[model samples]
Target: MSNKDIITLLHGAGGSYMHSLIKNVFMKLNDNYGEVGLEMLDDAAVINDTVISTDSFIVRPIFFKGGDIGRLSVSGTVNDIAMMGGNPIALSLAIVMEEGFPLSDLEKIVDSIKKTAEEADVHIVTGDTKVMEKGSLDKIIINTSGIGNRPPQLDYNINTLRKNRQPSRWLVPTNLRPGDKIIVSGTIGDHEISILSSREGIGFEANVKSDVAPLNKLMLKLLEVGGIADAKDPTRGGLADLLNDWSEKSGLGIYIKEEDIPVREEVRAAVEFLGMDILELSNEGKVVLAVSPEYEKDVLEELHSDPLGKYATTIGEVRKDISGVIMETVIGGQRYVGRPIGSPVPRIC
Candidate 1:
């Protein structure tokens, strides 16, 4: 069979391949009925100041060290809405399970979903459940759809930053300019590494847990501080794809310092041992922000104060001279970082 004749995991890995699939196949429908729709490719669609996002979770090893698929599903959808600068209000959940699946495990997952929703301060207003033939499906799969409202703080921040210029209606990825600072929330690669360690049973000396948690509260705090131009949570394609997307969309360049980007020592060791690129791994609970230079200090300070962003630091700045992602290595050398074809690790939510 030819390459186009079949579907591969790369098409779902959230990188170049996935982007191509979405643009060529799904986008053909082209039904954009909202402010930011499929064409704009923002975190979520905004309709009449309300934001909505939908996602499906299929991470292997339904239960992992730090969280289960239930937590992952809820956190993923909540973060998507938060990235769009919306305050999540409610969520709708749907689950499909194979026949003979453990009832105890199902109960555990349901309880986890309830607790996570409570933590995010969002309600599970509706849901559905279905059973599949045991041989036709894996253990289970989850889908979540979330609805959010625009917070006044986000509007105030955008208005304050854009003064004379027309401000964006929502936190779009392309709202970047030269001199804008890039800040990442805490460390990277923790989620993917934790998944690998659990699935492959690679017992590293230092225990690493998945950093999968809802970040709506942390995002709200940043909005309160003001001056954020755009925000995104680096997930399936990790930081490389996230940076590349920003550069391509904004028509600008990003210069990031390798030393400034936070990565846990344990995650680094595992990546090196596995011969994988840490930047191409997934992160479930980290966010990347572009802030105006004037508010960079305040934003970083606010992140430092939050429990979820204690390790947050400035990693880079947007540039007008260049037009792609450039990384300054720890040894003082520079290298061009391009978009990956797919994530090095797959099925990692």
Candidate 2:
């Protein structure tokens, strides 16, 4: 648990420990001095007008109710680049497999990767694969890196002093302002619940399928409507972590209503039975957006028009005077919504 120790599962859980690890260990390696850099800790790195992002997937079971590791690999990286207001163009995949792993399973995974790539309209330009000793590793692990194109004529600044300038075409968490609206793309916790069910062999009355899909198309529509201040995919740390990151990074307060956040009845019941907060669970397909108040209605309408964002709703608002995240409970009381800590569920993505 000390700073000078080796890596732990908690460090990969996308929580406080992970953030600290990145800041202390990896952040010092590169001085991203260009226009857009890693210093911001954004979802994707923007270099020379091109957006690039990389992610690794090692989910247990490899296959889930709604998505497999292969699909997750492609969509996860694609969503990362799209969250940065970029158009995903291509991807590269690297895979590590254990000896004695079934070739049929590998073929199924590869087929899924190809299908997802076609669905997302991105090319798989290159790839690599390696096999390890049977006892050296788990069944398989996948790493994907994606490239995207950012608009050339869009403002990237988020300074309030630059009021005369047009709103940024590129979305960043730091772009949030007071009075901006906060929106969630859809129900929370579906993906996590689905994974948990599959892992634990729990059978509920209603099947909880993972909400994992490529969201670049929905993001494109939002960008077309304009006025989007910031956007983040509620992946590893879920809605709570994403909102808390925005609040802490922007030095602004975000107030959300618990009842307003859309959640499937089955997922809610499962969360209650498991005694877990839905906000802390991961979502693979949802985007949390911060939009200008003036365009809030339009943004909601545009989101509703897209199949991916059919359940989009405004769940909160940004506050310049306050800091941190607060949630109004169903009972009319408010409580602090802190960033997730530790690895509540591991190998989730």
Candidate 3:
């Protein structure tokens, strides 16, 4: 193989190896920044204030039903910034590809990265790439990091949240009153189904697809409309896990109406077929919003303006005394729901 095309182990050795790796592989992807970065290589980047996060994806199948590793890599990082209440600004990507991987597939991945970024409006600023011997690794693995400044409007803090605070003052859901309403944006479990359908080689009975999407746009609008006491992306553990954690942290009870919970029939059927609890399935593009009842309409209105939140609705409420999560059965009973204890489907974020 031509030296320019072939990867050498020296690229990873950290001295000349790392330098050549950065020069030959990483530089081609990110372009030269400046001398400021020549002095240090940080795993983290400055976004705004103190908000920062990092994530890695080693999904077994690499490519899935609704999205591929490229989009996942970008969206996952963007979601992390969103989860931290920050606006996504820039990202860096790294790849470890096995030898003999097709250039066509690599081009597809690059195109996917560009498309996802264009939709999200975030820039891919820097990255690294390496190739291992054919037998040493999977076809590819991706690592990415991002940074962004949080808008002053979000003004998020865990402790400032409580019943007595101003609507915009922020209250930790731990203080959730028995009367707190649980709001969810759009549907759930579709992302898991998408991956399953791709992995298991099954087709949807209807037309269910992944909920994978970037929530930054809709969330910016929601923040403007007010009523968001707390917000989070229902990622790995699904809404059930998120609610249970909120219940435990705030020393309050969470109650939900079974009939009110949103689920597409195809997704529901897939969950039933796979013997998976719809509550524990992963979601990529969905968010969990806990808001006060009075402001719920304004919040919903903001959500409805965007395609992502067309189905936004109140699913449940917070309670004062129970300190656990419960769902009122459509059959006229209430059952406690707990956080998912195990990794039901890993690498979902």
User: How well does each candidate superpose onto the true structure, as a TM-score?
Assistant: 0.97, 0.94, 0.79
For residues 235-281, write the lDDT of model 1, one tens digit per residue: 98899999999999888999999999899999999999888887788
Q: Which lDDT value does model 2 have at 28?
A: 91
Candidate 2: where are CA atoms >4 Å away? Answer: 1-4, 152-169, 201-206
Judge candidate 2 against the unseen true structure and give its global Cα lDDT, from 0 to 1.
0.86
In model 2, how large is the Cα lDDT of residue 336?
A: 94
Q: Return the TM-score for candidate 3, rounded to 2 decimals.
A: 0.79
Tens digit of per-residue lDDT, candidate 3, span 1-349: 7876775543332223445566565665553343212222222233225345466766646677678888888887787667545678888899889999899988998999999999988899889999999899868888878876757556533323434554422223433555657888988888877777766544544356677777777777776665567677776667776787677656778888888878998888888887888887778888888776777888888888789999988998887766688888889898888766533654454
lDDT per residue for candidate 2 within 228-309, as digits (tens), equals 7888999988888898899988889999999999999999999888888888999999999888887789889988888888
- Candidate 1 vs candidate 3: the TM-score winner is 1
In candidate 3, the residue pairs with backbone N, CA or C atoms under 3 Å apart (3 or more residues apart, or in different chains) clash, namely 161-170, 161-171, 161-172, 162-171, 174-250, 178-318, 178-319, 178-320, 180-318, 182-316
The C-alpha stretches of model 3 lying farther than 4 A from their native spots are 1-48, 156-163, 166-178, 201-206, 346-349
Consecutive 10-residue window with the lowest summed lDDT within model 1: 198-207
Backbone clashes (count) for model 2 = 0
Ranking 2 against 3 by TM-score, winner = 2
The candidate with the higher lDDT, 1 or 2, is: 1
